[model samples]
Target chain A: MNLWRLPRLRAGALAVWRRNILVWRKLFVPALLMNFGEPVLYLLGLGFGLGHFVGDMSGMPYLAFLASGIIASSAMTTASFEGMYSVFTRMVPQKTYEAILATPLEVDDILAGEMLWCATKSLFSGIAILAVATLLGVVAGWQALWVLPVVFLIGLCFAGPAMIMSSLASNYDFFNYYFVLVITPMFILCGVFYPISTLPAVAQGAVQLLPLTHAVMLTRSLVAGAELTQPVLHITVLAVYAAISYYIAVILVRRKLLV
Target chain B: MWFPPDWPGLSHSNFNRHAITFYNAGSMDTVENEVMAADAPTIRARGLCKQFADRKAVDGIDFDVYPGKCFGFVGPNGAGKTTTLRMAMGLTPLSGGTLTVFGQSIADHASAVRRRVGIVPQADNLDPDFSVEENLYIYASFFALPRAQVEARIDALLAFMSLGDRRRAKTTTLSGGMQRRLTIARALINAPELIVLDEPTTGLDPQARHVIWGRLNELKSRGKTLLLTTHYMEEAERLCDELIIMDHGRILAQGPPRELIERHVEPEVIEVRGEEGAALQELVASSGCRQERMDTSLYCYSRDAAPLIESLKGLHGLKFVHRPTGLEDVFLRLTGRELRDQ
Candidate 1:
């Protein structure tokens, strides 16, 4: 019930966090390229090739519209990759968590470190796309920088559920169901490619229930300098998703490893 | 050195873990030395038990590990040694009973207790992503050891494990012996007083096992407290100052290896085998020595080997060996020769 007390959040977790950064830095070029390159291709390829025919939607250029949407989705995708594959690999096959568990670190510290690392990776992705879009002139004034923090939130938000998947997974193949059933559907229906208002009324309401839609809405408004519609509602939804799933994720990891 | 440079699942939040308590003390090594001299147990378990969904993994076991000594648990594959060790580490929650380390119940103060302990798990869990030295540094960071001190300690540990030349080699690239040594070095990174090794040399060749045994002996000589589980009877006899032979989730016998040998087995053994062993069985029985029989061999035990050897002298086509009874005799006497897991 007390989610705040759930995470150990100790200096031990920082060691785990620092360890991840050290490894990431060692493989910086490939790690950065994988997270950054795909999104830019999505932004340029779909933004121009697809945007040319689509023209403007809701009085905005299609390329600009897609850029902000991609920012939020990038956070979701990158964090999901980390939370699912990396977390599972560390927890199971590599037995890295077992090694750390032998140290002063508790299970709470390991999972907290993992979620935070996932968030950090999410930021890396969102920021790269944000920078690219800013250079392309789609991004607005300094207000667009606010997406950095939101992207972080989205990263943490998405990482929680993705970690739950990782905890539940028995093998790497188990992640395919998550990507296919959960992530891909959200990517398509969450308005990254087009506005959700175009959907049928019943389908529009269904997409609103998904966390990615709220993420897309927040990033689009901030990056495109657009008017907000119930921004508090969007932020609240992301926060709730983050908090509940994070709590569940910690429990799941405990059951999977420590217990 | 608060933790001799050698050497659960309580909910983490209930007890505050003091990671840097020793560093605050000006003379940390002196305090550690004092603790080592004291008789207080670094690890104590009473009525400790663990029940899995389908099995009672550990059934009401009691044990103690003292500082500046090496202790051992020798058992078959399914004898619950690993489960008991895991419970001692607080990696698994106990089904019953109390376990205390550093005189504090692990159920309440695991982190505080764990800060002074190091472990080499049965499976190789080295982080393949990092090189040997980087892996050591990362493990050190978990204990929050000062970076400068850890840098110095890592060098010493690498040298101690004979890994000075391979500091930057990726862990995946290391041979099994080298990786096991690195795992041992990682365990010592925090300079823990209590080092728990689970099957430290299970898969190693004879040369590799000897290298490990030598390193373990050096750790013991350096006054680090060690608790380990091994299938190697010779390793147990050579290294363990005190040991427990366990089976079916219970300790069948516990004592110094030599004492266990003396208590349960004859001082001498004559192992006879060949096509002629059956013909020699009556001769062995006639000698009045206690004996056991396998498919084609007869193992005779006696307080003296004179009669057993005297009968075999001019015999042809009979292979025989005479040796002193060892821990293996006591172990097989108590636990039986049936395959535990199979």
Candidate 2:
């Protein structure tokens, strides 16, 4: 009758993470192709095509301006897809979660492992974009190395909410709405393509409220070698997302996996 | 690493606190001595209940599975067999009452309890992406087993399950029987003191079923405790030393297979199937042979079958089969012939 029991996180989650990695390794090439393909196309198409007209935005070429946003959004998309689509497949269609539950691993362990894998996959996509942008001479200095850990934190932020969605998913069809409504809007409105300043004053305020916007702000400032005015606030917002969503994900996934 | 000194179900065995050592702490001779020396059951359920919204999946069932023995939950589909097995493994939470594994309350220390127990679920949920050996390796990691130790055991387990030939094969490519065997091998990675198999051979062919049954018997002889659930009467009769027959989420009968069969069913059974089944039923009735009818067949049970067979032979156009009565009759008598679906 007690339905509000919180999950207990334990060391067993690493095993679940290890299992996903073992399986993911078998198809690394295809995964890498998917991870790198989209961001590269966006960087080339949008940065070059759009940069032709938008010459300089507050002091930098549009390409450099867009590179950091690409890194942040890549982390968001990779972690979101990994958490929503991949985790759903493993939980429902494959029944992999049930198999893991049969062992000593609890549901919290399973969720933690999933989030870790999502973050790992995010690192793959984010670092790939960072490498490509660095080759194009968009990265200002070694201070841009700080973006790696930030990307991972962004991954955790988006993966948490995505896992919450996955816990409620009954079938693959449920994800279409999530992608179209939630993820697509974040991709376009979170300063990924253009500065929030271009939008109306109220719309800029709204954009700042999105987690991706905060990630983009940190990634852009750090990658541009520009001094951040409110670095702690940006990091605090993303950290809050990561922490709160993780707790919610654990509770939701436990209800889904345990009966 | 602390085990409660007064663990409820272990009855003063001198095994180490770590459950992993419970299986390997002593030799076969020592295990046999302990099996005889130990008085407590490895698993015990007292009025355990599991309610899902409105339905009672496991309704206040009580039973004990002794050490170094095979215990079975036998019932037809949706008879709560799987639920009871899940409850025992702590996979499903008990809605009411007490259930313990390794003498420890599962709700209080599920991970510790699960550390000493292995489970083969009703469906084979093997990682389709991994090869047979890789599946075993990853599963071993959940128990925190050392790489060298699990690697050594993986070789023996693969051979024992007759899966050595397919060690490198993708789990998806394996046959149903092979997948089932691989699952069993994966469950053994921890060298668990108790193994719970939920319908271990539900869908296998006769040969595959017999092969699995043989391996399960071998495990038992080596002093491992086993808990399994199945609807197959023959499987229950062959594999279980003690069992409980369940239906509608309740235990309807409990005893050893042979004892329950003797108690419920007559020693003999004769089947009459033909256009003349009614006449055969009448003859069986007049001869005082207990009989039940289904569709176009009549089942007659009696203390002896010679008279029943003799009476059936004179009835033209009627075919009859005479055989010894077994657990199936007991199951039918207790759970009935009505279809059960959930």
* Model 1 spans > 4 angstroms off: A1-5, B1-38, B276-278
Q: Report the lDDT tens digits of candidate 1 across residue range A129-200.
A: 988898788887889989999999999899999999989999999999999999999999999988999999
Model 2 lDDT tens row, A50-146: 9999987757888998998889988998899889889999998899988888888877788888888888888888888888898888899999989
Tell me model 2's lDDT, rounded to 2 decimals: 0.84
What are the per-residue Cα lDDT tens digits for candidate 1 across B92-120? Answer: 77889999888887876778778899899
lDDT (Cα, 0-100) at B113 in candidate 2: 83
Give the Cα error of residue A172 in candidate 1, in Å: 1.1
TM-score of chain A of 2: 0.95
CAPRI grade, predicted model 2: medium
> Which residue segments of model 2 deviate by more than 4 Å?
A1-6, B1-37, B277-279
How much lDDT does candidate 1 score? 0.85
Could you report the DockQ of all the candidates, in the order they appear? Answer: 0.58, 0.67
